[model samples]
Target: MGTFKIEGGHQLKGKIQPQGAKNEALQILCAVLLTPELVTINNIPDIIDVNKLINLLKKLGVKVENIGKGSYTFQADEVNLEYLESDAFKIDGRGLRGSIMIVGPLLARFGKGYIPKPGGDKIGRRRLDTHFEGLINLGAKFRYSKEDQFYGVEAEYLTGTYMLLEEASVTGTANIVMAAVLARGTTTIYNAACEPYLQQLCKMLNRMGAKISGVGSNMLIIEGVKALGGTEHRMLPDMIEIGSWIGLAAMTKSELTITNVSWDDLGVIPSVFRKLGITVEKQGDDIHIPAHTNGYEIQSYIDGSILTISDAPWPGFTPDLLSIILVVATQARGSVLIHQKMFESRLFFVDKLIDMGAKIILCDPHRATVIGHDFKSTLKATTMTSPDIRAGVSLLIAALSAKGTSTIQNIEQIDRGYENIDSRLRAIGAKIERVD
Candidate 1:
């Protein structure tokens, strides 16, 4: 396992650019299989999960070429359908959760799609029923193998229909839309996830000759096209990474500028950070965070009640950044409650922060109460292990603001999302190094 050795209590300055959105890259890569023409994608982040999916595409006979820095062109004209039954494919497909999305495109273009049970963060139960159920609603026959833990969907021809999703799942909505684009009739999806990434996917499909409307709305309408053509797409900057950098600047009392962040797309992120007393200033397309020399204070309700930050669907705060918020609140001037509504085990990392002498209460599996140290007390460094991607970055931020050196194990979790994180931090005067 790789590790990170960090020297704490150092202030970082200079500018950092957020990488391509990891969530959007996964969806856009899977959508490449929907067309036979050349699809050129720019701003592809060089991360483990995204690279794994690209390798899987190559093994399936998709012709892929690296055109430039963070740019790739893919053509899936001669996909190897037979490879899906191989033992090698079973092992490769089980490496990441994003592999599940390939099934929708394959089933839509070809006649069949198969995938092994995917593996990802051990945060909680992320069921695949939403994906399969959505495909089944589009006239596809679904089958599952209990002994092998594999899922398969097949159909001679799919006919579109209306569907109201039980939950507004991002991946599920993306999967079903990819399939419905090639169906026989109009498909209307109500209660669809309107995340900017999903909206990007829908807009990209429209550019590829698929008829889709209602961009950036909860309801989507897709009209089946005979075939889709090639189109170019550029991914947006990762908002989650941008949020992490904001928290990092506040926690370490540094002045850092995050460049090229899509300000309008970052819904409620800036406001939520401001609620924690951090300065998120907009200087054109970039976000400039000044040093919090006196520490920040959490805001209370209009009725003078304690502040509670919770995650919900789009237009609400993202659950992925809750870990960063919890870590940043440790040194703020007042208290805040972080309610992680989507995943159960995401809050379990608080014990490690508590070990570092931060005042935190693990209210339960879904909530945590943070009592800010207000910079009067500095966190003492300690050795720890990373449990997941978000938690790993949160711990790294905590270590950077701590009083001494700290060692973090299993940094592969951190590498899964962020691209060249240590080098990026080093350029901004951070004392972080990768150790093998």
Candidate 2:
């Protein structure tokens, strides 16, 4: 396991540009399989998870060309469907949770798609029911093999129908939409995840000749086409990373500017941080967070109730940043409740923050109450392990604001999401180094 040795108590400066949206890149890369022509994608994040998916695509015989940094052209004209049955594919498909998305496009075009049970962060149980059920609604057959922990779907022809999802799962919505794009008739999805990334996916599909409407709403209507053609697409900035950078600036009392942050798509993120008494200034498309020298404060409800921040569907605060908010609150002037309703074990990382001297009360598996220290006491640096991607970055933020050097092991979890995090932070005056 690699480690990050960070020396805390230094304020970071300079501007950092957020990488391309990792979530969007995953879905877009899978969508490339729907067409046999060249599909050019720009601003792809060079994170571990995305790289894994790219390599997996190469193994499946997609002709991938790296035209430039963060740009790639993919042509799936000669996809080796036989590779799906190989043991190597079983192992490769299991290495990435995003690998499950490839099944949708594969099943749509090739009549069959198979994947080993996908692997990702151990935050909670992420069920594939939404994806499979949506496909089944479109007249696909699903099967599972408990012995090999594999899943497969097949359809000689898919007929579109309406589906009201049980949950607004982002990846689930993307997978079903990709499958539905090539179906025989019209398809309507209700309660679909309408996050910016999903909207980008829908728009990209439309550019590829698929007739999809309601680009930014919970209800999406897709008219099936005979075949999709290749098209170029550019990904949005990673909002989760942008949120993390904002939290990092406040905790370290730093003046930092995040550039080109697609402000309109960042629905509730800026306002949510503003609720924490942090100044999220809008300079064109950039977000400028000034040094919180006097320390930021948490805002209470007008009715004098302790402010509560929770996750919901699009236009709501993302659960991915709840850990960042919780960490940022540790140094704020007031108290706030963080409810991580999406995952049961995400809040368990608060114990690591407690060990670092933050005043946090883990109310339950899904909730935590944080009482701010207002920078009256600096966190004491110590050794810790990264539990997951978001929590790992949250702990790294805490370490950067601590009084001394800290060691964070299992940093691979962080790399799965963030692109060259240590190097990027160092460029902006952060005292962090990677120890391989």
Candidate 3:
């Protein structure tokens, strides 16, 4: 594990660009296995999870080349199917959750696919039922071995059909879509996740010679084709990262400008922050967060009830960002409740913030009440450990506004998503150092 030593109470200035969407990159990289032609991708984030996926693709015998910084060209024309039966895959596929996506394209292009039980952030029980059930509905034979913890799927070829998902899981939708793209007949998926990341994936597949309709809706119709061709794709900016930066600016009294944010795609994120009384300015393509000298305050609803911020599906405020919202709320003037409906364990990080002098009550595993300090008192720095990717960044934001130097260990969790986070923070005048 690595550590970050941060000297707090310094306001930051200047511009920073968010890397490519981490979640999107996972889906896009796995889709490379769908075609035999060269698939070129741009704006690939330099993060640990993404790099791990890239290396996994190479180990599976996909010809991958780095064209430039954040650019790569992949050709899956000569994939080694035998590797899937090896013990190496059983070990390699367990590193990240996105590995589950590779099974879809492999089953589509070839007759079989194998993957080890996937692992990711231990926020809650993330099930693979959606992925496996969707594939089985498309005429694939699925089986799991309890002894090895391996999932195996095989079929002569998939036959597309109509299926309604139990939940609109983002990665589950991507996996099934990849499988359905090459299956015979037409596949109609209802109750799908239509996040911009999934939308971009559908668009890229359409450009590669697949027919998919209902790009921006919960219902998607995909007509199977004999084979897919190669196409170039550029990932959108990371909305989660942009939202984090906005919260960081307000917490530290920094005037920060985030460039190339694709403002139209950031649905409900800016408004969610603005509800916290943070100053959010949309200047063309960039978002500007001015220092709140008066301190941010929570806005009340029309009925004069205390405000509540929670997570939901796509159009809803993303569940991934609630941690950032929770940390930022500590410095606001009024009290608000944060409900993390999706993951129960994510709220446990609040104890660390409370130890830093912020006023908070852990209502339960899924809820927390934050009473803002109104900038009247700064948080006292202390030693802490990062639990996961989003929580790590949230703690970093809190530490930046604290009164003294704080040491944060287990920063490897933060590096899994954000690319060059320390260097990026330093560029904007933050006093953070990376220590081994």
Candidate 4:
């Protein structure tokens, strides 16, 4: 296990470049398995999860060549589907939910796909029933074997049709889209996830000869084709990390600029942060954060009352970022309620925040009202362990702002998302050291 030791009360000041999104890179990598030709991807985040997925792909006989900094050429000219039966092939699948996405492309290209149950944050019950249902609608046969704890799918000829997902699952929608791209007919998907990551996936698939429309909306219309070719793509900068940097600058009164941020793709995220009293200035592809901000006051409703911040599916505030927003809100001048509707267990970390001598109310598993103390370097340090990626970042925010030294353990969860986080924080003057 690894931990972060931080010396608090130092302001982070400097410019930083955000890393490529881990979520988007995962789906795009799996899409590589759809074609044997060469696919070159640039700006790929060098994170733990991305590395794990790449290792898993290499074990399946995909020839991956590094073409320089943050660039790689992947050639899956000969996929050894036999590896799907080995225990080594199942290592990444059981540890990350993104591993489940490989099932769709493997089945589409090789006629058969074997995948074990996926593992991710235990925030709630992440069911694969919807993924299975979506594939079955595409003329695929599914079988579950208890001996291997694997789900097998086979299809001689896949035909696409209309699919209404049970929920707007991020990876589930991705799996179905990849499978539908090469099917026999047109595929219509309703209530699909339209996150920017998904939109990028659709665009990449289209460049590879899959006709997909409504890229940024819930209703996707995919015109299936016989085959897809390899294409070059550059992964988008991580919005979640950009958001975290914004929160860091606001909380620490630091001047920071995030380079290479896509302003057009960040729908509702900038406005959401502005509502929390954070100002974001966009200059071309850069997001500039002004220094020495007083942690703006949360604006009240028209009736002059407190307001609330909540999360929803795409086009709304993302649930993954609410934790970071809440931590930032804790230093603001007013009160706000954070309602996490997506996960029942995400708000459990507020107790740790409360133990740090902050004013907070754990209304339940789904809601927490945070009162900003504006301590501004008055909080005493403490020991805590990270629970998830987003929460881990939030803890780092808290640790960085505390009055004394603080220790945060189990940073592997954080490494799964952010790339070279400790070094990046060091670049901005955050006094954090990583120890194993």
CA displacement after TM-score superposition, residue 32 of candidate 4 (Å): 0.1
Question: What value does the lDDT take at residue 213 in candidate 3?
Answer: 98
The superposed Cα distance between candidate 2 and the true structure at residue 378, in angstroms, equals 0.8
Clashes of 2: 0
Lowest-lDDT window of 10 residues in candidate 3? 288-297
Stretches > 4 Å off in candidate 3: none
Q: What are the clashing pairs of model 3?
A: none
lDDT of each: 0.96, 0.96, 0.95, 0.88
Clashes of each: 0, 0, 0, 0
lDDT of 4 by residue, 54-169 (tens): 98899889999999888999999989888998887766568777888998999888888888887777687778887889999999999998876889889997898998888998
Residue 59 in candidate 1 has what lDDT? Answer: 97
In model 1, where do residues sit more than 4 Å from their true spots? Answer: none
lDDT of 2 by residue, 216-326 (tens): 999999999999999999999999999999999999999999999999999999999999999999999999999989998899999999999999989788999999999
- When 1 and 4 are scored with lDDT, the better candidate is 1
After superposition on all CA atoms, how large is the RMSD of candidate 1? 0.6
| Alpha-carbon RMSD, each predicted model | 0.6, 0.6, 0.7, 1.4
Per-model TM-score on C-alpha atoms: 0.99, 0.99, 0.99, 0.97
lDDT of 1: 0.96
lDDT tens readout by residue for model 1, 58-173: 99999999999999999999999999999999999999999999999999999789999999999999988888898999999999999999999999988889999999999999
Error of 4 at 249 (Å): 0.6
Q: Write the per-residue lDDT of candidate 3 for residues 1-436, one digit (tens) a residue.
A: 7999999999999999999999999999999999999999999999999999999999999999999999999999999999998998899999998999999999999978899998889898888999999999999999999999999999899999999999999999999999999999999999999999999999999999999999889999999999999999999999999999999999998999999999889999999999999989989999998877788889999898889999999988999999999999999989899999988899999999999999999999998999999998889999999999999999999999998999999999999999999999999999999999
